[model samples]
Target: MLSRTLLCVAFASASTPLLADTVWLKNGDKLTGTIKVFDGGKLLLNTKYAGDIPLDWKEIKTLESDQHLLVKQDATTGEISKSLQPAEDGKVTLANGDAPKTVELASIQQIMKPKPVVTDLVWKGNIDAALDFQRAENDTDDYNIAFKTSATHGQWRHNAKGEYNRESQDSLTTTNNWDAEYSVDRFFTDKWFWDGRITYKRDTIEDLARQRTVGTGPGYQFWDDELGAFKVGALLNRTDFEYSNGEKDNFYSVSGTWDYNRYLIGKKVEFFTNGEVGKPISGVADYSLETEVGLRYKVTEWASLNLKAEKDIISGSDNGDLDKTRYTAGFGVAW
Candidate 1:
């Protein structure tokens, strides 16, 4: 009886199978793991021992899995299929337990695992803060905190951002500014979108106590890819402002905005700039412009070091020298 029990245990151990996705490399290396994603020239693989490994897609000669994945080469050619067979001569065969389909290596843009449960909405963003204090002969303090969050579902996206800044010297506040904005973008085509935004702002240092703006416009994407993207738009804005000098003003404005961002060093470092220009039809200022240029270097998956410079310009205002420039360097986190 003891011998039969040992034999049964041995049979069970031998029959238990190990299931994994497989990748064949150009240099005759084989990797077995759970394939997570193929995006931006890289493949993310989750393994039992190594946690997560990022492999260059160019180095992979072929991939195979029993799992179903969605593959896309262009706008119209996309399908969900079972597995990828090994590559021969820079092409791979996809097997869906039926007749195999072959595709070129270079034409593939994205590969995603099909989820058992459908999920449409996704969220991503970043936040950063900076602080500086000096307590020598004269005490000084400065700080800024900002966060941006975005969500996307199907052809629609929503973004929200907030920022706060303050500065003081010798127990006297020299600067204070804060702003919050919410925006929505609806994509009608690949490169064109319609956007609407609402913004609330306050600046005690600029002698503007409060400002509110609502705008809507069309935007165009010049290019959006793995490396970077550029977008520009124009909006007709209605703004209401209250100044410290007991002046309350409201007017319409023509506003233009530009946003550009690029990634470097395998997407660990990023350079970005976003700016806005506003010309009031009948208000206290002829023109108002604000721009921010920044660099973010990723320290890890969640943390990064960031440096930023900001310039705010206002022309033809009744207030004296409302223009300002500031620089900040600090750390940030993202998920």
Candidate 2:
């Protein structure tokens, strides 16, 4: 038994040399590490001391690898190669075997695992929770929890999200909210898409006991890259609302949604914002708007610290206190 364990350890140690790749920077720096990802003009390398470091591709003079890589040249063209060697005039030689090809570095748009790599449906999500407590002549407690998930396959993307918030003062409920939303997008072109969304929410602070909205429209992706994405959509929607005073109303509206996200500081920090606005064509209110902004610091691959602020405003309200705002800071996990 001892001999078998020792043999396995020795075998693993002998195979370590085959995993390394070499990167040469324009500044005459040479780094040997494992390339994990290269996207949006940045490359991620896993090094012994740095763990994972992101380097701008423009700073790299050359890349040499014996590991198999999937390189996509354009939207519809791709190739698999086991070697990348420098060629003349900003070109690289992709060697699969005896048939070697040269392509310009700027022409390569994306890279991933080698072909025959079966990609399952991409699924990702995050969850966060926060709590605030105050003790004085009157005690107050606040809790907020949120979850979001998304799945993508080919040109179709789907997302679902939910949030719950509650506040109590002197053991009496002061504010409570429950919200959920689902959306789907189908892409026919790189920049143009169709989207549909549904939302349900109940809020006490806004004097809204229940609200439901449904919409579908055309959307445009301004840009979607490794650094971030920006998108805008115009929707025609139907909304129904029930107030706490037992009053009910419904309306048809023209709505718009916009989202923007960016990553900085070597992808360790993120800034995100999204907003929605609607103008009623057959209702009492002139307009309604909701917006949220968030900043997140990635502590690890799956954990982060986040701060968020949100605001909602209704242009004309039966109740004077229909406008609401909130701020929360907490931790989140994603995968």
Candidate 3:
């Protein structure tokens, strides 16, 4: 009976999964979890009891993990280590091959899981939808949906986005519009890139019934990491517009565009904004501006609540000027 009990215990131990990553803090607290990633001066750990916890890199005294991870010490160079071993204070040992290497924690720029096969490809995006309906007195209905997606491989990146909005009051259409855009970027260096984009928009009820644009320019990528990303560009565009009465106009324009986002509060909240502004060389339109700003609060790992505001303006159009603004609160899923 004693032998059988020992055999059962050994089998159970062998079948259990291991969560062996450990971190020792400067304040004498020790934590056990799976190391997720380290970026922007924060080391993220996934704990069974507390979900994900972000520890300041400066507060970590030492850490150990058996998982192979990529440790980047600089912008252009990195190495994959078989395991991380605790070294002296403020240092870590990369146990790779027979010769173990030790380095200062402060010198490590980033740490993440190494993807051997698909290391060059990354994809991420989000979708949001909002709707409002009322049945008292004058009936009303409003709906908005939008999606943006991007993928990067090697030195090239591709982006696509689309949005639809519709509203009705008293069984009459008050607003109806949709837009779509696609863009590509080719990196000349780590921070510099060339951008080419095409966009189309249509509004059934507005004076400016349709718009089409094509543009190309140089852009600067300030930074892109686990925390967030920011980029800005200047574009010279060929634009065409069709009015509700079928009047057509075309012009050449110069524009500035920007996209930015940042994560905060242990990745629980995010702030993002992107926009473009342009002035026409001819009199088709004096100036045009389109922009959106938004915030998202993560309700769970993959779910969020979002609030957004958008503005569109076109001055000096032959069919008169155009201006519109919208605000929305909605739910979204992101990855």
Candidate 4:
């Protein structure tokens, strides 16, 4: 039995010369039989017994052999041979034009393999619950409640969110708000994606009046599989007053955002900034800018506390109209 094993080993070694070959460097250098890989700026070759060989781009002139060839010219890929050769003395030969030039094989830089895009599917979703007791100087102090949930599957995603706020003065009237937003994400690549969203908000002015709005837009999401994500997009929204004296209005709104997830701290955390530039396309409302910046701290694995301050931007409008700034801080949980 041992003799049989020894015979197999000897056979493998004998055939290794064909199955594996050497890559000759123009600088009187050589690499034994190995597999080669090229990355952004590096060159590499791997040998079964030895390991990987790294080479500098400047050190190589051309890669060629009787069997295979890989050469890069003007920039990369100067093929020294008719076809791209694989696993020779070098991963590929640096194409320096058709001229003969002396290069140091020792100076050859081995390339590194590209970071493989993980095919492993990862899915994460969460719900959020929050309550807010806010103080507005010279205005109404109110309690606000909100909920948000989101999930992603491969290139497609879904997000749902809703908020309800009950606003009351120290002794006067009360106001109530109900809002909901839903979005779908479509991916072009891991780095680039577009999403579509529909949103609606209804406000009851504490028994005095009610107002509502509906809108939709296409947006971009820069969601890194690692780190956090940011989104930028536009919305065409219109508001109608059912029992209020305010004018009805339709708006062309552009928005941008930057966000970060909890990476440094073990606890969940996120920082976000967003802004919108809007122009009233119909009815009578002023063009405006609205910006907000905030931070969120995880209260649990599926929930967090959110705090935000916002300001409105006004341009091309004379009157203040319905333009106002709001500051919001709240805590919410999810499972």
Candidate 5:
């Protein structure tokens, strides 16, 4: 009976998945967890007891992992190793089947799990919605929703975004508008790309009822990583405007666009902003600008609370000048 009980306990332990990664700190404390990624001078570790933890790379003495990983040294391309073996303090060994390479910890630039295939696609995006209702002297209703998504495969990336808003007071509509845009980028190098985009907007209660634009430009990606990304571009656009009184105008424009985001406090909070500013060559409008800045706080792994402000301005439309500003607080999901 005693032998049978011991065998049963051993079997259960063998069946459980092992947290095979280990990191040793300079202060003589040892940690066991799965290594997630290392970037921006931080190494992320996943542990069952404490969740994901970010450790400063400088504080690490040595680390080892049995899982296959890609280790990037300095700025060179990464090499995959079957496992990491502990070496002397401040050094590690990358063990393959026949070749074992030892390198200093300070020389390692990044570490991450290797993708299953070289051309694997990655997709990420988020959606947010807000609603307000008042039932007093002046009944008011307002609704707003926005979404943005992107997919990247190899050297190509595709992006799409849209927004809808409506507001009513005393059973009368005061604002209604919707807009959508799609863009594609083709990379010629790691940090440089060309982009083509098309956009359309419609306003049901405004004099400038419709706007359409097509543009192409060159962009520079400053950086993209687990923490955040920022990119800027300049475009030459052909735009058409239609007014409610059967008036139409078309013109060429020069524009600049930017998108930026950052994560803070161990990825609990995010700051984001994206916008476009343009000057029309034909004087259809003195200038046009559309922008939104927002912050999101993660409430859970996938859900978040968001606050945002948006501005839309057309300085000299044919029918009249248009300027609007809106503030929103809402909940969202991000992946």
Candidate 6:
């Protein structure tokens, strides 16, 4: 019923001419013109003197204009509808009033179509070292030596981290857990951004755990320039944690992120700080306000190294004894 309603509004409506609208039918043919399709697969495409060609297809290709050097065709039958909902990532969601499929504009050829820049594209990378000391420095306190590296492009970011943490004053030592992760984000305008994450985390404390999270809420770009920009955004990451202890906990975070960096000398100075004051929204969970700061140097225009230090201030009614500080130092090269 929803699909039919949208199809009526999309295809049943009277449309002016669309400039260079193109459609390629499933039978191995491409049509350049304006097209409107109903829920039952009925399609109307209009092109110059050739008139409107009614079509029915099992599937549909893209609707594009201006590419094939077909600009002379002119938009006489329908006005390119700005009606197509534009996404922040600058792409059309291709909602023919039917099941929606996301399409990235960067990969698509620009048409007379409207592609709104829904989300800003961001690219970043860093390597840093941290020095950490446990509060008790006793037999059970986690002591550490660490290393970390990360690089990110567009909506995706990846990180690899490792460390050596000792339990107690025992000569017995344990290797820091090895960790790797991938994360992505989508911006839905109106100061709203959605984050999706996938992780494989291994470390001394938790052994091995794969976590997933979706963070979304109000966000803004405070500053953007060669020096740095302040981004003040609020978000909530609903997370699922599967620990090596054969235990499961679900946590949600109401957090804020602040990131800024600039060049210093021939190197670069990068700083990122994120804090989340949150408690487990479900099940039995650990809560903490986590933060990390770092400075990185660019060896060349393509390489960088950094030192990072982090502190977790645990203060909920359930986590008074679980306090710890951690650090890591590392570097990376990128193209």
Error of 2 at 240 (Å): 1.6
* Best of the two (1, 5) by lDDT: 5
For each candidate in turn, the TM-score is 0.74, 0.77, 0.80, 0.49, 0.80, 0.44
- On the 0 to 100 scale, the lDDT of residue 242 in model 4 is 43
User: Residue by residue across 55-107, what tens digits does model 6's lDDT show?
Assistant: 55334443443322111011122122333433433344444434644554333
Model 4: per-residue Cα lDDT over 16-108, one tens digit each = 856454455559776765445442234455566655565454455444433233332222223333232333443443333465344444433
Error of 5 at 65 (Å): 3.4
Task: Give the C-alpha miss distance for residue 121 in model 2, angstroms.
Answer: 4.6
For model 3, residues 1-335, the per-residue Cα lDDT tens digits are 99999999999999997767999999999999999888667888988887678788999999999998988886545788999999999999999989999999999977888766755346788999888999999999999999998986657899999999999999899999999999999988768999999999999999889999999999999977667889999999999999989899999999999999988877799999999999998888889999999999999988999999999999988789989999999999888
Q: Listing every candidate in turn, what is its Cα RMSD in Å to the true structure after a full C-alpha superposition?
A: 5.4, 4.6, 3.9, 13.1, 4.1, 19.1
- List runs of model 6 lying over 4 Å from the truth: 1-123, 128-171, 179-181, 188-192, 198-200, 206-212, 241-245, 251-253, 265-268, 281-286, 317-321
Residue pairs clashing in model 1 are none
lDDT of each: 0.83, 0.80, 0.90, 0.51, 0.90, 0.47
Please, what are the lDDT tens digits per residue for candidate 1 over residues 1-335?
Answer: 99999999999999998889998888988999998777556777878877667778889888887778877675334667778877686687888766889998788866776544434344667899999999999999999999987775556879898999999999999989899999998978667899899999988776778989999999987865445568899999999878888888788999999988887866689898988999998856889998999999989988999999999887887764467899999999976
After superposition, which runs of candidate 4 have C-alpha atoms over 4 Å from their true positions?
1-141, 206-218, 235-243, 250-268, 289-291, 310-320
Question: How high is the lDDT of residue 23 in model 6?
Answer: 61
In the range 1-335, model 5's lDDT, one tens digit per residue, is 99999999999999998757999999999999999888667788888787778788999999999988988874436788899999999999999988899999999877888777752345679999998999999999999999999876657889999999999999999999999999999988668999999999999999989999999999998866667778999999999989888899999999999999998877899999999999998868899999999999999989999999999999986678889999999999999
Task: Please give the distance, in angstroms, between residue 152's alpha carbon in candidate 4 and its true position after superposition.
Answer: 1.7
Q: Which consecutive 10 residues in model 5 have the weakest lDDT in total?
A: 114-123
Candidate 5, lDDT over the whole model: 0.90
Model 3 global lDDT (CA atoms, 0 to 1): 0.90
Off by over 4 Å in 5: 2-18, 22-32, 38-63, 68-119
